[model samples]
Target: MLHLMIAIPAFARMYNVSCKMCHVAFPKLNGFGQAFADNGYVFAGKQGEIYRNLGDDRARTFKELPLAVRFTHYVAASYDGGKAMTDFQSPWSVKFLLGGAPNERINFYAYVIFEKGLPPFFEDAWIDLHGFFGLPFSLTLGQFQISDLMFMRETRLTRSDFYIYKVGPYKITYHRGALLGTPIGDFGVVNGNGLSALNGKYYDDNPSKWFFGHLPLPADFGLFGLWGEDYDTLGNYVRLYRLGLDWRGVFESFYPFFQILVGFDNDTSNLFYGGFFGVDYAPGGDGVVSLLFNYVDAPANSPYRNERLATLALRYSHYVLTNLKVFAEGEGWLFKRSLALTLGVDFAF
Candidate 1:
């Protein structure tokens, strides 16, 4: 399943506002949406503070559970190498999503998956506390993607992925960690082992950790670095470093974004580099068209060798309602010499 993230409809229900207040579409955030997130999942001032606690003085609770569901269902057809295939992949992913202010200073976000496996799993479960100790900083602790600080796919408008974040040679996306940051910048240290660490009771057999620092630059640009010194499963000594730069711009109805990263590993003698460029164009009413291209260049020792790897995708999404969108995308996976077309629906409510 290709994971999908959303600006949950719960906010719309709680604030009594239209979904468009934060989203240009179901998952694509507008400028106001970025501000809402920066302000602890609420509107500026006291508008988002209108909720009344259902609990007593000592505890604050919601009058209604602030929860929503997001899912994807798709039909994919592709020709890879010499093989051609077509299939129905309905319910590609189903998520129980929730996020909101638990109190004045704390906003939390999480999503649990219900795919093929029983006893569903959590993809994101983090609490963000603003103005900690009455200072200018914030704190976040839980499981999340470090890549978000560099180039967040959660708010992107494409059905395809930002492949750089998933590249094996410089991988640094998922884990459990504590982050100290503000809107301008953040620093974090997470278990260097990825999701495996979270599944293993957040335990680490090695003492090393992954360290990351991100700073926002002027003009909607950002820079970040990730460092890791750890041992591989086979006990091979490893030291990895990554540097990324991201930028985004909006011209009326068109929004364009670009992100690139360079990574090196001393132990494996591997060097990796890649980036993705995408643009979203909303000409008018209820519809969005997006184009994305991701490319990677890896050393010969890496899985993707020779720099002959890339993916190009074009997608169109139409909102039938605020919480439901139907989309179709045509993609070329240059790495596998495959071409695909997928018809899908995304629902968030």
Candidate 2:
């Protein structure tokens, strides 16, 4: 069954020659191994023809409200210390989505998720303001994933899949607020705040000589940091601060990826401290047979390291079908090391 699921998508991704040509139900999780193969081995993106209709041609044609919907479903089961199960059971999730560019300079996407046995909830809702201030900078405000040092993906090495276990507290939540992204020289700097008041900064209206490096591979090696405070209307609040190091060209090309993160949390009475380490291959833009690894050390030190959970994962994805996608993935955890292998197929339309 897994072989068949992947085979079809692998052929399709190779045939299309475009990754985003086939839209994914979950832009974050990507799809099954084979589905990726069918889409040319790339994650979903806005540049593909599948969403090319979102450009000016369609925007100008419609003057009223415009919308797009995305849906996703997953049924995965695994066996670690227990016997192998026959059917998909263990973990399952469904999601509803809507998004599109309603105007020439603005675009947005939202996702609401419904877990198998939890309360139906809204997962993410954020908007991007493009070409604002007549500069290359834009402000995104909403309750969405924090665009800090990590790329939100299950690929292990990307941000240390800290909260994969159902009961693990390592899972992160999207915070509410705004971010400022500007191109400083050839690099970029993105300053974000959790609360509205703290969004103010000296460079809000002006450009700086600073630079932002590429992901997986930041151009210049340096240290980055983040601090945030969340408050209610009455002034009661919670505060968190994080420090990260961005390393460049640190190892051989075979395993040329590395990053480190430390965080402190404060909530009036207590403080907590936590940290994570990630090491993987390069971006694998075209296709690199590589391995990705992540490990998170979380402690319950008052508010600084509030999560108090530990997680580790390893994953490998390849482009056997073409630049689109191909191959499969399997992940396990020490908590419930007996039953959780996710076999999926990825593809693009």
Candidate 3:
């Protein structure tokens, strides 16, 4: 059987509370948990305070800057009608989570990832402003995964075949020489030496240049060009700019969310747009069901054209020990024609 774990025991230590208070399962946030995040990870009453100094006249010192570590391991097997691949991955990944309130109105959250065959980097680093000019709006800044705004990827227990966070469409490029032959007028012929020349430029299947590098613009100019464009060695296109918005709210017993994003491809100057709308229905204890629809539209010249994905997931959990949980989840990706079933245990001390 496949196994998945979404536990975050660090937050439990920071609040000195039971894990069930915020999560129906390990990573799935309950209604109160959602409010805790929206409120800068602070509780509503005096019990949620983390700062030492209270008055405006005093310089406040943090009572605690909580840091927690999580280790995840799993074994997976997949069959696609041909050969089946089975592998055991233990201690597969690790994460360092840091989150807390610095002051009354500002909260910070950051996490670092340590995975096999990849350099360690900060996966998510963002600051949330509780209120802007006394309005209900908040501003988030830093390098963070934008998809978390609506879909809440972390809360999902099943491994995804297609990475949902990669919402942008990829640009497609064709070699100019391939177009020369046939009805398009031949500029050259395939020589016995496996080389051809076009317009006084020698073209080889392996050693020919198809694109040129454009100097990157300074960040201050508000336009950043690709650092290098070596299509053969590097990628063909670059992600230029992205703007997005996400909103989550509760109406009666349903938690609804909507998010949209627009991105530009630096190589083609084409636009890619995508969004998702979802609702979570949690009747009472230990079980929650959700339905989500996700869609992405690439530019006409993009390789994928348009890709869409939808998912339905269910999570159920219970505590056998004080901070230990037995949880299981089932999720299906409608478009991919795949289903993921997970059974895992979460231990938090």
Question: Which residue pairs collide, candidate 3?
Answer: none
lDDT (10s digit) by residue, model 1, range 257-324: 99999887774457788899999998658888999999988777864465547999999998898779
Query: Whole-model lDDT, candidate 3?
Result: 0.49
Candidate 2 lDDT over 1-349, as tens digits, reads 0000111222233234333333221122233433542232233542232333455665432232223222222345557566776455323444454444444356565656666668766656667665656667655556555423343432232212544221122223344545454453112223222222332554222221112232332474545555544442455554545555545343543434345655544533343334444544434353333333444454444432334444454444444443234333455455445434444333222
Against the true structure, what is each candidate's TM-score? Answer: 0.91, 0.53, 0.57
RMSD of each: 3.5, 10.6, 14.9
User: Local distance difference test, per candidate?
Assistant: 0.79, 0.40, 0.49
Candidate 3 residues 274-333, lDDT tens each? 666666665655555555666666767764355545665554555466455555555655
Better model by lDDT, 2 or 3? 3
Highest-scoring model, lDDT = 1
Candidate 3 residue-pair clash tally: 0
Task: Provide the global lDDT of candidate 1 against the true structure.
Answer: 0.79
Q: Estimate candidate 3's RMSD in Å.
A: 14.9
Show model 2 residue runs off by greater than 4 Å: 1-17, 20-87, 96-104, 117-121, 154-172, 184-223, 230-238, 247-256, 267-290, 298-310, 317-340, 346-349
What's the CA error at residue 211 for candidate 2, in Å? 20
